[model samples]
Target: MSTLTEELANTDLLWDVPQATLEFLAEHSAPRTLASGEVLLCPELENGHVYLLLTGTLTVHFGTPDSPMIRELAQGSSVGEVSIIDDTRPSAYVIAKETCRVFPIHRHLIHQLLAESNPFARNLLQMLTRWLKSNTQRIVSDRMQIWELTDQVNIDGLTGLYNRRWLDNAFPRLLTQSWKKGQALCVLMVDVDNFKSYNDDNGHLGGDRALMAMGEVLKTTVRPYDFAARYGGEEFLILLPNTSLNEGVAVAERIRHCSESKAVAYANEHSVPGITVSTPLPNITVSIGLALNQSDSVSELIAAADAQLYRAKMDGRNCVRY
Candidate 1:
């Protein structure tokens, strides 16, 4: 293995530093060994020295110990520079991604090096700049990744509509808002007519495209204040605030007519080899059920809409019932 001074001489941060200053760092710095998954700095607890990574990798995370990682420090990288320079608590947790060795450089030692060599000072400034820039880019990248993951969690991938998970989370809040503002609330339950038979005649892929088309129709039909979501397979729901039963029924009828009049098409250019689909697919009809918010719970309101939906199906499909 190379001696501490030998390793320090190889590092860009220290390469331009004078031999005398490098010797000072080799003498003052203490070696550290971390096990895989070992935590070096806890954002909530520690505010301390920077580390010169000699071997292995370190990951940085914000928010909590189990939070998503924001950045990684590779071999020959510096860690904790941001906290050391600012003289504040670290905004992130630093952990070892694998067994690692590091040199913990204290603030006093850094100050001594600054005084000893102008080259060392310049090198340190450059190192800090690179660290800051890298961290800023990582933060932005991490934010975008987090947003995409959150969207995947709340949105239906097949139809590009809000999923049942989002509806369950958001409906209570919407109901509370309506109650507080003394405004009416309404729910529309929509289902494709004979979707089972449709899926049997046309494959699941065709059914998916049909559902996607229905989703688009609802997207273009609803008002800006309205909320629409895929309740489950072949079922959709819309929430309308400040809408009466009559208004809700009218919206449901409009959606029903629109769905009946439209044709769905599917063709994926990027589909697997030898996999192809027909375009300008068949037209389909839908049955809609409406219910106004009553002096009852959300479940009861949904049940009311479901009951009306059954009535619509019994009265023959492609119609709205309330």
Candidate 2:
């Protein structure tokens, strides 16, 4: 590390160093103190400063609909690097998690830092590397999280799949195409049997876990090009273009069977019991209902699946009623 760089690390603001590429910040860089809980970088909002926390913690969050717990930043953790690095929208909301102090470099200062210093260059490279690394990790983590989050709007949160919203947006177009082609339009409504009790008995969180698991079940069991999404709390809707009611039901049964065989670790349990009385509940099961809409509006299709789902629940849990 350079002396300038080390100095840069100490003060609330890093002023001069050969590491920076531009000398113009000799005129513009300033310092500020951020009290705890202050918002520094808003996810959906915009600001021009690249906030570098000199002390305390920061929390980074997203705009998810339900239980949107997100990232935390320690001292030395930087925010707004993406905006500084490129011209793009801010991807997350940031708040000072604790009493914090920061060096808020205006965009001009950022360009100066990039243009004038060596360590700044090195630091920029390192930050970029860190940024790239953080981004890559983010991509993987977000993919998994997108896999995990429930209650997504426009599409189903489970299955990492499309939903009624998708159909609402696409079905009209799809129907038009199908109408012109004189082809069969296959729409499936899939319900997890007794899911109300599944979530209710397990607790909402447990229900979320189950739904997430069920989503994976559908993804794995279905053929490519078939789209599925959590239609609502416990039911998922599927659309199979260019297929028959028979084909759609066939896929639904496979999904149902997969759910029955599918078992989750039963999160509410305490400790493992089998490995010398340590394993948790052995498994949890799912029941499903299948309904197909071959010659009706999207509403009718969803209604049909929902009806079957109700029947499945009424008949028994863990069985598929098609």
Candidate 3:
């Protein structure tokens, strides 16, 4: 309802700014409106001006110059200042998502104001700098929070490893990188042998202990570059970079042997048989199959390794091979 300058005066954002300083900005900044589908600037080019949203909305976008991924902008938000300060590529394409009115404040005019009055200009600069700092901090905190939330969403409760979601997110990237590098990246699929019978015979508690031990073995036995994640129920997966099927099988064998050597203990009174402070239960076994990343599609790699795992189970539950 009110004019842009009137809105600025009432917003209280520039309340700390001196009266003379406000008069100078009034002369310098311009009120401009962009239609619903209009683009004020392509952030990829020069960050020509900074904008303060007076009314309406905008969208930050991705994609080609003509077609973009549009995301919303709220009222009272400022734009383009971040690019001016950091000199980095723009994070997204910003366009007027709706009929938006922006008060564009040119940096050249602000510099001129600085020359006109030292105290007033210094005060305004300090305020702007502080706002930018606070804004950057909030963005960083938000990203960290989102990362934690994503981890919780995409992680398996039973094995503390990446679940199906993460595989969907990362496997394609891995395949591309491996193909580009002309080096093999391998996937090793591991499963505890007779896990159902073990659960039936010893209970889920026994199966859990075995799972934990096997997870630990995978962590310790693999190369430094390898990443291991619980694939799903009674299943685990490991990524081996720059490795051939032969080398991958060797790593899988190491993990299998390590898990088999360690005995698992049950907390229940009679589940594991021999219960002691040091040693609580008998050793358990796992079977692992290695699939070369360069040689297989994501699904094919997983299936190949799984098929090999089935073979390991048939051969006798406690082995690892390519």
Instruction: State the TM-score for model 3.
Output: 0.59
Candidate 2: global Cα-lDDT?
0.64
* Top candidate, metric lDDT: 1
- Any runs in candidate 2 off by more than 4 Å, and if so which? 1-159, 266-296, 317-322
Residue 120's C-alpha lDDT in candidate 2? Answer: 58
Query: How close to the true structure is residue 84 of candidate 2, measured as C-alpha lDDT?
Result: 67
The global Cα lDDT (0 to 1) of model 3 is: 0.72
Using TM-score as the measure, which candidate wins? Answer: 1
Q: Compared with the true structure, what per-residue lDDT tens digits does model 1 show for residues 182-243?
A: 88899999999999888888889889889999989999899999999999999999999999
For all candidates, the clash counts are 0, 22, 0
The models' CA-based lDDT, in order, is 0.85, 0.64, 0.72
Q: Which stretches of candidate 3 lie over 4 Å from their true place?
A: 1-117, 263-281, 293-296
Report the error of model 3 at residue 173, Å. Answer: 3.4
In order of TM-score, best first, we have: 1, 3, 2
Which wins on lDDT, candidate 2 or candidate 3?
Answer: 3
Clashing pairs in 3: none
